[model samples]
Target: MTEFADNVRQAAVAMRALFPATPMQRNAHLSAKYDADIWLKREDLSPVRSYKLRGAFNAMSKRIAENPDQQLFVCASAGNHAQGVAFVCNRLDRKGVIFMPVTTPQQKIDKTKVFGGEHIEVRLVGDYFDDCLRAAQEFCAAEGGQFLPPFDDPDVIEGQATVTMEILDQMPRVPDRIILPVGGGGLSAGARAYLNALNADVHLNFVEPKGGASLTAALEAREPVTLNKVDTFVDGAAVARIGANTFSVLSDTAPQDVLLATEDGVCTTILEMLNIEGIVLEPAGALSIKVLDDLRDEIRGQTVVCVSSGGNFDFERLPEVKERAQRYLGLKKYFILRLPQRPGALKDFLGMLGPDDDIARFEYLKKSARNFGSVLIGIETKSASNFERLFGLMEEAGFVFNDITDDETLVNFVI
Candidate 1:
């Protein structure tokens, strides 16, 4: 344990040449809301706007120190990891070949190029990440270049532990609990390793996106397993499988300590942080904060730290984030309505809505019959109970409708 702690401290000190430690900030708004001493490890403020660069830099720096001849680095990533590697490659003066899926957004691609500058090359490969990863591994082997894994490596884990090092140093006293966002588990694993080594009495909470609870799945199975499906909305942490190396460190995590935040729930947190707190957090960055509602009772009066992992949110997705958040809060809904073909029927149905209710979308799916037609409608209201009152009135008036807001399949196709 002492040896591991020493290694982490040494790694953190070595990182000073590249960049200083990220800040740990106490959030007054969250502290007041949760009745706890809420602190945020602002990894979102890092040079790459994420903690990923820590692992990437640690892995690359150590690799070169051990083998000076290793001049070329390779990695496959569509988002933060790619940018991390690019930044590190340029800083370390090493050649980097980054493979990204062809479908990756141009914004991310351009960011990677800007960070790497003349030190790296970008290759757009298959439409999926897995395909790009295979191509990168093959190319690395063929060219005899070292492949830098985003996570799942010893040096990377050591690098990520530096985050915990900074948190402990910045805080006036040891926190009662630390809340971490889990993706492929590198950050959590590293933090867990460091805390366990010191025999800290701190409680740990692991937050995962509900759609990609790979860490929960791994803990249940006692090993890493690939999920059959994953929701990519929280792309930063939407991993299909927990890394095997990381699982070894996190295997003993209690099920209760692993909280799952729904995609809509995360969006709600993102919006709240943006609108109320003036903080822009990416979906994955909001996971730890989103789970605070679940810990409202447990965390009261306790000093807790929530890691805001990244702030690489694209403003173009704001409308979608607002939409999901509205749906989650029950302020918005989509439904299929059976409206009478008669002209007065349309006017009467519109009148049925409460004053607070406003129509956002109205489209005809198809005229099912001469007397009746199916219309897709989206409504935004001030309160959730308004929907219940609105539905009751519709039933009484014989205005048939089906709420498709919660129907995933129907939403994917029609809404």
Candidate 2:
């Protein structure tokens, strides 16, 4: 075995001492839909409901073995990584200090606490992740404790490689393609390294949220670059910058292998997996699956594996997820219509509705002129083509309207 493969195998063996390998199940629903043999490496079933715990455990275990006198561990994270570190602290009976942004959801903080119990102390340090990370690093330096990075460390990368080791062992043969979600790139880098060492014939596809395409941006720049802004809707994988160490391993990857998934697009996949397969996936977890539509032609009849990285979804976000899915599917839209100030104006507009059209919202914006008034309307329809027909009717009837469904600025203020 190559050195990387040996390290991955060692990580896998070390993992078994803590918890059983996560399932690599063939997803019948996705396989039939995509016309391919689709498998999900279910990292969502890990003890921390994420593959992150593997890296944290592997890194800490190796460190402890080398120096048994080391007693303190420190890490900073907003979600999965925090839980992973906390879990390892509890498992190893070691004291750990975790720094998280004050803006972190209560659900995540609670889960981290549950996993760490008395072994970990969570410090709400700053409003932004970067600030919390700084605080954690300072604390680690002051206390002379080992700092456990979420993805930048080599040991953590080696730990994450264990997932690929399990995938190969569970499958009958090497998969034709493997899809991975990239955050700071720990899992992607590790898995890619191990798989490349084991079988050069396998195709690797990397998925990143469009709003936070750090990996894609880095690949284009030929180095890791920090994004000016990032949409944190997919919090689990929304990283503004890729880790320097993780990027080194992924730098040689071809640009064509990277795919970007929009937040709304990912929401659609999340809802589909929940409704159709009874699977609950966080936005990050759904990243790989969301890109299946884009890979339909290439993966047909071929064996493919998509890693469902985490299920750390907050139930409170369900409503927002549903809203995003509807918007992406074209089942919902918002518009500002100019209505004539005639007695039968409302009735004339209602007559244009298709059989499947439903008015979800309606409001009068203002009387821009004596002859007309601006109406804010939200419509839901059965099919996307329905909008074209509706628009034609509006044009023929001399009704003026503006579609604000995708206007982020306007929707944020008025919708």
Candidate 3:
């Protein structure tokens, strides 16, 4: 363990040539919210706005040092990892090929290009990430290039440990608890291993997106298993399968501490941090903060550290994030109201709305019968309880309504 710690320290020293240690600043908002000492390791402030660059740089550097003639590095990623690999390849003056799904956002592709400049080539392959992975690997093998695994590789995991090294160096003392967001599990495994290796008195808490609870599934089966379905709302931390190597390291941690956070819960945190703290966080970056309410009992009076992993958030998705948060908080709702095709009928329904309620959407579906029409109405209010009152008023006024906000299938079909 100590030997591994020494190696991680060496990696930290080497990383200084690229960028200084990421900050570990005490967060007053979180500390006050939980009545506990809370510090955040701001990996989001890294050159690539993520810790992924550490792994990509470390693995690539070691490989090149061993074989000077090996100049090609290849990877498949649609998000932060792509940017990370691109940034490192350009920084090290090595050639790289980054393959991303065809559906990947243009903002991300542009950012990756900006990072790689002339040192890398960006390839758009299949529509799905798995397809992109297959294409990337086949291309790498055919071209005799080194394939950089995003998280599963040993060297990559070792490099991610540098985060923990920085944490221990920056903080005044060892934290009583460390909250980590897990996707493929690289960051969590690396940070946990380093903390345990250093004999730090820290209880590790792993948080996964509820839609992609790969680590939770692995811990339950006592081994890694693939999830049949996963929601990609929290794209940064949503993985259908946890890496075998990562699960091997995580198997020793308390399974109960692995928290599966709702995507909406993470959205809530994202919006809260943005509005309340003036902090911009991507969905996955807010995972640790989202689960703090669940850990309130365990974390009170204890020093805690939450790693804000990445901030490469595209503003294009901000509307979706806001929508999800509103739905989760009951502040916004969509309903189908059956109204009689009469002028006073519409006026009566409008009068049912409370003073705080504002109509955000109004679409006439169609006339269902001789005297009734189906109208899709969206309402937004300052407080959640306003909806309850509005519903009661609608019911008392003899209007029939169906809430389709939480109905996934109906929403896709109608809304």
Q: Which candidate is the best by lDDT?
A: 1
- Tell me, by TM-score, which candidate is best: 1
Model 2, runs deviating above 4 Å = none
For candidate 1, lDDT tens digit of each residue in 1-415?
5988999899889878888888889999999999999999999999898999999998998899899999999999999999999999999999999999999999999999999999999999999999999999999989998998888998899889999988998999999999989999999999999999899888999999999999999989999999999999999999999998999999999999999999998999999999888998999999999999999999999999999999999999999899999999999999999999987998998888999999999999898998999999999999999999999999999999999999989988876
Q: Candidate order by TM-score, highest to lowest? A: 1, 3, 2
Q: Which clashing pairs does model 2 show?
A: none
**Candidate 3 regions with alpha-carbon error over 4 angstroms:** none
lDDT of 2 by residue, 1-415 (tens): 8998998788788788789999999999999999999999999999898999998998999899999999999999999999999999998999999999999999999999999999999999999999999999999989999999999899999999888788888998888888989999999999888877876578889999999999999988999999999999999899999999999999998988999999999999999999999899999999999999999999999999999999988989999899889989999999999999999989999999999999989999899999999999999998999999999999999999999999989988887
TM-score of 3: 0.98
lDDT of 3 by residue, 184-208 (tens): 9999889988987988888889999
TM-score of 1: 0.99
In model 2, which range of ten residues has the least summed lDDT? 192-201
Clash tally, candidates in order: 0, 0, 0
- Which stretch of 10 consecutive residues in model 1 shows the poorest summed lDDT? 14-23
